[model samples]
Target chain A: MAKILIVDDDEDFVSAVNLLLKSNGFDVAIANSRQEGMEIFDKDNPDLVLLDVMMDEPDDGFVMAQSLKKKAKNIPILMLTNVGQVTGMDFDKDSEMVPVDDFEQKPIMPNILLEKINQLLGK
Target chain B: MQIIDRQKVNEQIRDLKKKYGDDRSALMPILQDLQEIYEYLPDVVMQETAHSLGIHPVEVEGVASFYSFLRTKEKQGKYVIRLCRTISCDLAGKSNVARQLENEMGIKFGETTKDGKFTLEYTNCLGMCDRGPALMINDRLFAKVDPEKASQIIADCRRDFLKSDFPKVVPSDVKKAGPILDHDLKPAEAIKKALSMSRSEIINTIRESGLKGRGGAGFPTAVKWQLAGAAKGKNKYVVCNADEGEPGTFKDRMLLYEHTDFLLDGMTIGAYAIGASKGFIYLRGEYLYMKKYLEEALENRRSEHLLGKNILGKDGFNFDIRIRMGAGAYVCGEETALIESLEGYRGEPRNRPPFPVDTGFQGNPTIVNNVETFIDSALIIVKGSEWFNIHGTEKSKGMKIFSISGDCERPGIYEFPFGIKVSELLKEVGGEDTKAVQIGGASGHCISQKDFNRTIAFEDIGSGGSIIVFGPDTDMLQVARNFLEFFVEESCGQCTPCRDGNPKLLGGIEMLENGRCSFTYLNELKKLCETIQNASKCGLGQSSPNAFLSIVDNFKPEILGRVPEAD
Candidate 1:
């Protein structure tokens, strides 16, 4: 089973994502912040990372992702965000400027998110 | 925290100490050097820095946290894309540009890509107002960017990240009535004339010209010099504040570039008048490309004996200038913050009553003049006070350089005498479809179409010369939000009113933007703004609420629409 680390500030979102991932038979870990996420990443060496774009600060997710990448360059990162509704801008997953392997807007359907995770994990 | 190389950190600290000496002010530069070595300021390094400097860890951390450029943690991507979010850029479709980038990148503002290749963030201003929709990938700037162009630029960067070619900016095509000071005068000619006059004569000439500091404060230049000169201090200093971090303002860049000699000569003359042997030019980091040219100018002057010991071959008249680069802080443009940064501390605004002229830069009497102010001094000395006094209004004498950008056919620098009506300036700049104009970056006033008759003078809507035109299609609420956000990010967090109050204002604006604000909440926000304007310690916090107040005052219907309809 692949080890996935979910780093998000929203407890409800994290719990829902955690339940879905566990039912799919993946070992999961959770962190509430960029600092906590990095600590878990260093200890567990997760195969994939699920990150939120905004937490304590608007750019906290990006800052977290950058630090994670510095430690493990090849680990796939899937970013979660509700920024589209807020800023009224669509996110293009194929954008070279975004270092994420995949992007799922907030309030993601469990099935759709699972499909994205599976595809990114090449399972 | 990562275990940094102890020997290496110590050696670097030693080198920094050697370069800046044991003065407490060197704290900012030392921290900057450490930041460069370590991607982020590590805890171990901070402790080590504190130990080496003989200062407490809290001071180091406080200074580090105060500056936006200084990071305590490692969180930078390979390519950091900073999009300009100032009023002028916003008016010129910066949001569209940001939307394009976000859609292209699969990430919103302030996110690093999964591959660690890119980071998208919002920056205060890149000083490229005329060419709006600007963004910077590291130090290189891309202006006039649309969605398509943003995509193309990203593609090019991905293809060859090292040498991605972008459009080069040409100097402003300024329309002038006649040979102004900058255009007509030869380099060092004014300084030569000042050197011939006694120090009192130089000060009197500047006084008679009715010259004022052009750095937005509009303080009388002659009075500032006279105060510094009279102040009881042996090692008096002259500082030229070239940290033009104000959004939509790039006139200083032009002055530093084309007329380098005049700027240096102005500083030299100021140093001579103030009885100061040492001078410093606090250059902004964004304009690091201009450093080579500035250095060359200084080198030429030194060889010609225009600077350094025994200036102009005269005994007992000695002055030398050194360039100090700012590592990215907008508040450093404030004279006290600039001084604080000069002393190697975080760029925090010092409380007044002992102004910079009396107590500045190593607690010495220092006269901090704007880049233009010094250049103007050189001109007044050469051209005579009577000639200089002919232009401008009764209070604000001589011509001012206006950095006009956004919603104009010709968006560039323009030189005009004070008292020019807003409507006249709009017409001259080709702002045909203009709805509003934001003068003096974020801190300055917002002028509506009805107020276009107001003149540009110290008595009227005075400015440091940043005029950003907004078209009818632009949302004034969004413009106000952008300015509020800028203050929230740039505030040094020294006081509660500024650090906390700005974010509250931003939150209120965001609430309105999202159609969640109530009439009661809006009234509360107005009171909060008043408190911030009246209670904040520095000019930044005081002037921060101006845009929000003006937008609400002028465009009440637009903001009211943000409130949900009465049930």
Candidate 2:
């Protein structure tokens, strides 16, 4: 089972994600802030990172994703953004995407999230 | 005060080299100190700069003269007032504002006051279009100002300068004083000089003066002239890249208006420099006034025997300039695309190697330069290399003109020494509440508070002068996305990456707008943006992603979203 690190500000969400991954028979680590996420990433050396769009800081997720990629070039970064008009998602294209591996909208359905992660990791 | 000779200036440069380590690194700052001491960079100053920098003086000259912000010639003024006349400011009524300043100061746009208190000029957008009606007194900015307010500001500056015991001889306005072509010369005189000059002499004069192409690439003007001349074409042509496609840059338009003859003269001179008999100006279709001005000026020049064959009773050098208006296509600004547009094809960039200097325009040699670059040639010929060499540092030989716009107390075009500190520029032009300044125009980079220390020089900033300021409330992400939207709409749909990639990136912004995008989708958008920047074939495709990168890097939260905890 590949170990995954999920970085977000919400503790409850991290726990829920951990439980969901554990039931799927995968090793999972959680970080609640960018600093903690970086530490966890260094310690666990996870195969992938599921990053939240907004944390304690705005765009903290993008910054964390950049940091993660800088640390490990091959490790895929799957970003998590909130869904709805309030966040404005209509402007993105496949070409304009950052150097990140993949992205998923919030209100994450388990099947879609799993599919995206699997596809990114080429599992 | 003595006009410092070349050897003495070189010694000062040498001392500065010991004080500051890398001469190339110290290029702008050294020029700044030199300009402070000498008011403008003379040819000797350039020689000194090269000696101090341990590089070819031509390199220093190239960098200095390419930018519009640096001033090299002498001016009889205590103050230089630059007004923003770019499209955005035009929409915001800059003409009236400029006229007001002219009337109140009792000096035309390039003329110093009889009392030697002020010189006035108008320039393109300085990037603060959102605030509109911008003006610069040296490096200081005043934005959202009306005619009356501008009058008050100028009056106050003059009064303050006059009263001060420690008056800096060049007026507090020297920092804002760019090349003032405020002189009114007959259109025929301007055309006659350009028509009479020999190709090699023209090239050599420009070479000695160290002028660089102003159309984004910063190529040496003299080298391009030489190449185009030697291209062995039976029918060679010269082109003025007046398709001013950059979003926030409007210096060319100002050049078209204030010095109409100056530009035509430069083109004629360029034609002579490159051994070309025919010339075309591919002006952006949007500049209705510029088209009218050039057409009338061309007519006037023709009437005076300056444009026709063997005019000056010599070996019959025949040349004429015509205007070809563009139909709202941004890509036409690119050299190859411009050639394509002129040839009645879709404006798309052609691969290089057989550059336009050789195989261009109907399979003949062609040379293209921005309007400002060509205008400087007239001054270069009139003044000589020694005159052009004085204003900027060793690397950048002459003055650069910048269009200042955006949220500031006052904003407009500013001409100054090449190496003036960003902080000093902000202090000079940006009002007290200034937050950030965008260098290079809308498509240019957004310099945040952190990068304020970076000097505004050719080596650091990529292209010609355009400084746009922003205040506390400015939405950087929105501003950047707006820039992207411009690209999306303007893309000619010639290439897949530019056509498809532009819309896709724009779609990401849409997702952000709807607020429906998950953080994951936004991340995907970021990934795609990188591909566009790295993979695109043309400048539009490459730079289209710049605003997105700046937004993603600098204003992340605005584009990304927050997620609630799973309850």
Candidate 3:
């Protein structure tokens, strides 16, 4: 089983995703802010990470992705954010700036999210 | 009129319409150019402009009358001498210079000399607080003007030989420097970095930096960019609010002169992020000395392919910036009022529901950021978010450039982190014996020594970087009176609360000065301040009573039942 780390400020969303990832037979770890996410990333070292675009600030998730990639270059980051819906902004993954493996808007179907996560883990 | 030339007037109006645009927003620059040619706006020329722009003649008159700089009733002198009368200049012996100027010109402040050589006027904050007793003769700024210097300046104007003795770009007296001041990013480096990223990526980089608007209002900069970028609009605008009219604020004036390339890069980056094709720097008429320099910088950027079509060779990313001259209205510092002024209307703020982000500047998505905010955003694009946000407090998250003046031993610009304590700052500026500190300009609070422990942050006491310190001998009542009078002159009269309420507050201060106010009436006046804050239509009106309320709150014991001054 692959371990996944969830870093988002939305606690209820984190809990729901945690349950979904755990029931799918993956180990789950969670952190709320950028600092906490970094500390947990160093501590837990999850195989894949689920991140949010807007945490304490508007683009915390993207900033954290750059940091995480610097720490572990091959670790997959699945950016799940409603920033497009929230601010009506359209964004996609970029190699240098975003550095995420896959991007999806929020309210995704549970099965698709699971399939995306497993595919990133190469299961 | 002085022999109106019909063909010449028609020709000039046509050329102005072609240079600026046929759009209603082109009204201000057109009128400004015409005013330059006619010495003042003549009735016939205004009529020609009105017919050309398809606006009502009455509306044109309304706009001309609203701004203090515009002259419609009579012709102005060739040299317009505007003396700074705001508190900083007042404390620096501005009245003596005024008296000397009046004597030299043989005219009062609001009069033109008989020979039509000079027009004398008093203006609010020429953005020369650190070098006070400053005056502007036409577009040339003369700082530290004493009575003797005033005589020489008048003599120079008479000889028609007033050469710009000062340097082309006046350097800011930066007492203490930090990262933003020390940013060494070259010209267009940030623009190239931004061009490589997507629109949302550009915004996300700024958002990640946690930069807030440095214009005293702590609105998040990234959020403003994001909203403006996402708003439904075929045409969008990024306006740099360069109207540095606050009483003791002079940092923007320095930034415009010193960091010319940085400001242009920041503005270009903002235009790219928001998909804006056109931009404007609504510079205050006080800083008219810096206009040609800024225009030169814009032209240089265009030549370097950092501003014009396909910026840095990026396809379909065409953007250019123009300089708009503000005709001396302090209220136009407010964004909506700036927009109204941009539209060639009275510089009065509009009601917000469709805010500037959604419907602004001719009903398109427009984002107006402060000069400092734009510069900071551009620097953040190159330096990364962690480098910028690491200095200040968690919420405030950046170093703020302070224009420190008044009662301080070392009065100049200082870049201190946002969460610095008042006492710490006073010590740094050799103003430890400070009695009161006006954190913002006239619209900010007058905090006494008791609040010295408080930090300067958005979560604590946020400021737009105008730190005017008052010593022990300074009169607190007089400070309150000066700020109230500023509001009274600056109020747009669009809303009743600000129009009527401010004069009443000034009257109350006068009563306090004459030792005639009762506690009950003073309480009533406080309530009126609250009413003005609650009922005013815009931010300027709401903040009019801030200095008074803060003074009364902080110095209640000294202010109440105070002995009257000797007549």
Among the numbered candidates, top TM-score falls to 3
- Model 2 per-residue lDDT tens digits across residues A1-123: 988898887777788888888888788988888889999998889998888755764435645664566578899888776622333322121211133677666778888878887888798
In candidate 1, how many clashes are counted? 12
Model 1, B1-567: lDDT tens digits are 356798888898999989877667677768777776776688778888889889998888987877666678665666778888877777778888999898888998878887767888887777778778788886677878898989987887677554423333336546544335346778889988998887756877887898988999998898677656645567889998999988889888778877778888899998888789998889887765566678788898999999988898778888988778787789999999999989878888998756777688888889999998988888889889988789899988888998998887788889989888999999998997799998888898888888999999999999998998888887888788888888888898888988998899899988898999988888888899899989988889899889888888888888898898743
- Docking category of candidate 1: incorrect
B428: Cα error in model 3, Å: 1.3
Q: Per-prediction DockQ scores?
A: 0.01, 0.01, 0.08
Candidate 1, residue B464: the lDDT equals 96
- The residue ranges of model 3 lying beyond 4 angstroms of the native Cα positions read A1-123, B165-167, B561-567
Candidate order, TM-score descending:
3, 1, 2
lDDT sort, best first = 3, 1, 2
Candidate 1 achieves a global lDDT of: 0.81
Clashing pairs in 3: none
Q: Give the alpha-carbon lDDT of every model.
A: 0.81, 0.67, 0.88
Best by DockQ: 3
**Residue B260 in model 2: lDDT:** 70
Model 2 chain B worst lDDT run, 10 consecutive residues? B165-174
Using TM-score as the measure, name the better of candidate 2 and candidate 3.
3
Compute the lDDT of residue B352 as modeled in candidate 2. Answer: 60
Q: Estimate how well candidate 2 is docked, as a DockQ score.
A: 0.01
Candidate 3 positional error at B155, Å: 1.8
